[model samples]
Target: MKSELEKREILLESGTNEVEIIEFYLGGQSFGINVHKLREIVPYEPEAMTSLPESGPSMKGMLLLRGKTVPLVDLGSHLRKRQVENSVERKVVLVCEFNREVNSFLVDGVNQIHRISWKDVKPLDDFFTPYKPRFTGCITVDGREVMIVDLEHVITEIFPEQTIFGEGEVEGAEEADAFKRGSRQEVKILVAEDSNIIRNQIVSILKSSGYEQVTSFVNGEECWNGLNMLKAEAAHKGQDLREYADLLISDIEMPSMDGLTLCKKIKTDPVMKELTVIMFSSLINEQLAHKCQEVGADGHISKPQIHALVKMLDEYCLK
Candidate 1:
């Protein structure tokens, strides 16, 4: 389960723009996932799983791992790979947690954890594959290329009920809406999120809550460039960047640049230091919360917690 890279203790400092990706195999192809998403790994035991009737093709069954009933999803079947479920493969279960939910993914085997910079991970989208949502990007390790799997996208497919941004989160924000309507038209928000589905979800939620003046970028690199352009015009008028934008909503994992590195750049720059930066990422657990603080993020919210994000916007922007 461990490679030479994983043999030693790994200490990654906050805001360094580096990431650890775990390589795993499925149907003879290698895939990568963020190391932070892993809760634990265990050998797959067919005798331990209780089969359920009418389960989806990808759903193998549910397992009671450490007293928690977690659904096991077959990564190979979900990705439409042949000879995976019945093939002679080294079965392993990767227990992963993200967006405050736990799920295990069945894979052939896991290789090793590789330490790489976010800059090296190139954004990849293959038109030939129908599972575009599961494809996040690609990274080269040991002279071999591996596709980075977006677990958020995978879990969303398995449980579509969890993706909805309900209207309940906007009910109490009317008071702030009143103030905003009287003071301005809409709050100018800059969002930097890579996933199209999640980015659109956030934008839809914001517009539904009456915050319509939102600008979105695919990654922190593009967002940062957009800010510098905005800064130039504001500088010419002897104004700060905050006057033009209310706040920035950024995700921690992206291709060219990550949120923490982007936040650090913004906080350290005198021109953009006053602007508020909020981290809205799946990696915002208690352990990783301090990294947000280290990068000078004003606030941090976990993924799928759209209600909390709405409230934070009310307190920070509308108020």
Candidate 2:
């Protein structure tokens, strides 16, 4: 195992807006995930898996490692491709941790890591919006197109209750909803999110909570531009951004700009710095949270925590 100091050294400094992706192969196609999402690659041991009775097909089984129960997911099966099954392949398991959970993904082989800027990652077109495409984005690494797996969506598929801004209320949500119906909240919010489904859900939640002034952008770049537009409009009219928007909620990963860059830009601004900035994503962890803090995020919240999110709203927006 790599020592703690060695692990921290491997991590890039905050607000660089770059990612180290560990590329791997499954069914002869290239796929990758953020290195921060990865824990370690382990040799596959078929005899160690304990099968689950009612689990879905893509779920291979569970493995007990170092006093932790880690689920194993078959990358090929999940992607619905089986090109490697009949061939002579040496499988390896990529143990990964994200959103405060760990799982092992079975893949055909591994490749070298690639360091690239987040701006280079291209978002998929809107045609994929109707279907739940399990990819964050794709990047061309040395002329090879590598699809970055959306492991958050993969886990959500396996556990439907944990959707981003997802399913049934989180206990106090009912009371919060009741309170929302009884009052009017004039909070103006700006949101930047990449996923269409998740984006809509957030808008829906905010509207349901009596927040009428909400503006959303597909990615951080667009959000930044929107803020600039507000700035320009305010400058020309001698108004203030305070009259337009009060806060910003941004997701970490996006096509043209990532959340760290957005937060850093917002904090360093003279006038816009006063706006409260909250960073939210499905990939929030201690390491990423520390990075968010370094970039001057006022608060960091993970996805699907309706109750907690509402409480945060109460603290900053409602109180």
Best by lDDT: 1
Query: What is candidate 1's TM-score against the reference?
Result: 0.91
* Local distance difference test values of all predictions, in order: 0.83, 0.80
lDDT of 1 by residue, 1-319 (tens): 4333333324677788888898988787889898878878899988778788998999999987877678999988988776555655558999887888888999888888888899999766556367667877899887888999888887778787766354466554455556565443467899999988889989977776677888999998999999999999998999867778989999999988999999999999988998889999988877578889988999999887888887788788766
TM-score of each: 0.91, 0.90
Model 2 segments more than 4 A misplaced:
1-11, 85-89, 125-132, 170-184
lDDT of 2 by residue, 1-319 (tens): 2353237534777777787788988888899988777778788888778889998989999977777679999877888867755653568888987766788988888887787898999876787664335998889988988989888888888877656655555434445565654443678888899888788888887777666578999988899899998998988899988888888889987778888899999889997898898998766887788889999999998776765766676678765
The reply for model 1, stretches above 4 Å from the true place, is: 1-10, 84-89, 125-129, 172-177, 180-186
Candidate 1 pairs with clashing backbones:
none
lDDT (Cα, 0-100) at 180 in candidate 1: 62
RMSD of each predicted structure: 2.7, 2.6
TM-score of 2: 0.90
Worst 10 residues of 1 by lDDT: 1-10
